[model samples]
Target: MEEWTVKVNHCAVKKEKPQTDQLEFGRIFTDHMFVMDYSEPLGWHDARIVPYQPLTIDPSAMIFHYGQSVFEGLKAYQTPEGTIQLFRPEKNLQRLNRSNDRLCIPAIDEAFILEALKQLIYLDKEWIPSAEGTSLYIRPFIISTEPYIGVAPSHQYKFVIILSPVGAYYKEGINPVKIAVENHYVRAVKGGTGEAKTGGNYASSLKAQETCSQKGFAQVLWLDGVEKKYIEEVGSMNVFFKINGKVYTPMLNGSILEGVTRNSVIQLLKHWNIPVIEEKLSMEKLYQAYLDGELEEAFGTGTAAVISPIGQLSWEDKDLMINNGTTGELAKSLYTTLTNIQYGKEADPFHWVEKVSEAYAVK
Candidate 1:
């Protein structure tokens, strides 16, 4: 494999950084971004780190018409020693390729992209917040840029990475939140785009999420699309339930996304000698477990929230209060441990943290 070089273009003007205490998730962006263009013969080329600005694409671009796009999310944390690091970034890049394969988009060189991401983060390292629950949120995405509006995959595409200084994903932070079981709209079915981290999967979930939000719920617990009886996920996050001292999460099954955070949580549980099972968990069975006083805890895992405890689950006019509407001991421990590892405050037994050196940003 040939090595790829990224060119850098500094921005003429800089934007004022937001106060770390008042930072909100995805609301503020950094000064620079990384972009690369792809075409047939040259493949992915002309990789560059440029000033953050609006993209100028043709109105008839295929991404606007057919939605041939894929994205991945991760974060960069500032440690107490002022070093910048990433958590399981390789997993995100691998998943991005999987999404590209599923969407019929061209595959990117994961190693090269990872280097480019490190350089980009190094350039904007100042934007990484050092607050208790703050970090620089990273969004990497690819979009079809071909001008043709037909229903086929595009020959041209663009890969971009942008950074955002973010605080907690939820206003409730690590506290427990209310969740509603979605019974109407389905997010995805087996043999669909659910397994891929694509925009269409999230676009299809807005209706159910909106309804639940209006009903005073923090998020909606999505059910399986075909049967509408099995638990799938919780509002953009992978869910896990603790019933009778065992942790259970819905199996991938070609529809549920393979979340990086979810995998880490399972690994952590196993490391602690906890039994974690992945299988098709039906809503009926879970509710029965709750009735039997076996559902001890419930939570959702994702890159943004990390671990959001599901305090109350409302299903079919029946509210299931989990752990007396408080964060469970295991959930709290997992959150603290994961965040501590990311921030370099604890020993990283899994070697999941990848440090970004200042030399990467040197011209």
Candidate 2:
């Protein structure tokens, strides 16, 4: 495995950290961030952990012109005994490489980045919130930073990982959400960048999101681009549905993101001896299921929310309420189970949580 780091010139560990209960999601950042440079010829270099701050970039950087950027989001939680643990770090690493390949970004050695990430979290250990809903959110990204604005991949790039202290993603305490089923604007197509965590895929969804908001929906549930019938994914997370004691989700058809939370939920359900099916779930089938009263629940999953239940779905002058506009039994159980493992409240038999050694705990 490759390794790289330049010792921090100035450490920004919080002097008097605020209470975790008062935190807002992704607002309070830890003292330091990890950054590095990558070029075609030089590979990766100048890797370092620096005080958190805004980056200085040329106005005409390639990323600015061509949207050549990709990013991943995950979190580290402070257990009851004060250990910082990350859930399925390897999954994020693998997904990052998949995004790198799709975006033509230089990929870093996973071990190297993971090591650097843990070290940074160790240095800012005090900033990690220990409250029930608080966690240290990590955002790792790669961007084209070269001055030239040509369409081709830039020679210079930046790989950075920043930490933020976040409260639970469901600020309103997981009161159901309304999603506007998107039939006009598609989030990703088969040959598109949706499967990859590239910025362009998200950038393309902004307008649709705006339209959804204007239509009084919390999010836009996207469908396949070509057929416009099969459900693809929700705006930022993959979605799941429960019907008649079975769990079903859209298969990875190169038009949807394979989210970490989605995968975890699948494992957890299977562990509970529940049947899970990954197939093309279409809007018509979902509508029919809801009409038949077979659809028990629907929810979206991501690192941010873990699980957010969908209370209502609106499409073309019609409204469908899931489980009477309340968080269903399945949604509630899934959320509780996942968070239990995250905060060490439940037995993590799957060994999903990776603990940071006590020796490296910042004193």
lDDT of 1 by residue, 1-363 (tens): 266789999889889999866898887899999999999898999999999999999999999989899999999999999999999999999999999999999999999999999999998888998878889999999999999988998999999999999986655557999999999999999989999999999899998888988889989999998999999999999999999989999998988999999999999999999999999999999999999999999999999999999999999989999999999999999999999999999999999999999779748
Best by lDDT: 1
Best by TM-score: 1
Across residues 1-363, which tens digit of lDDT does each residue of candidate 2 receive?
A: 443455664563444566756788776777888899987678988888888889999999998899988899999998888878999898898999999988888787888788778878888877888777889899999999999967898889999999888877776677789999998888889988889998888888999999889878889999899988998888798999998889999999888898999999999899889899999998899999988889889999998889989999986777999989899888888898999898888899889998867655333
Which residue pairs of candidate 1 clash? none
Question: Please, what is the TM-score per model?
Answer: 0.98, 0.95
Query: What is the lDDT, from 0 to 100, of the residue 63 in candidate 2?
Result: 87
How high a TM-score does candidate 1 get? Answer: 0.98
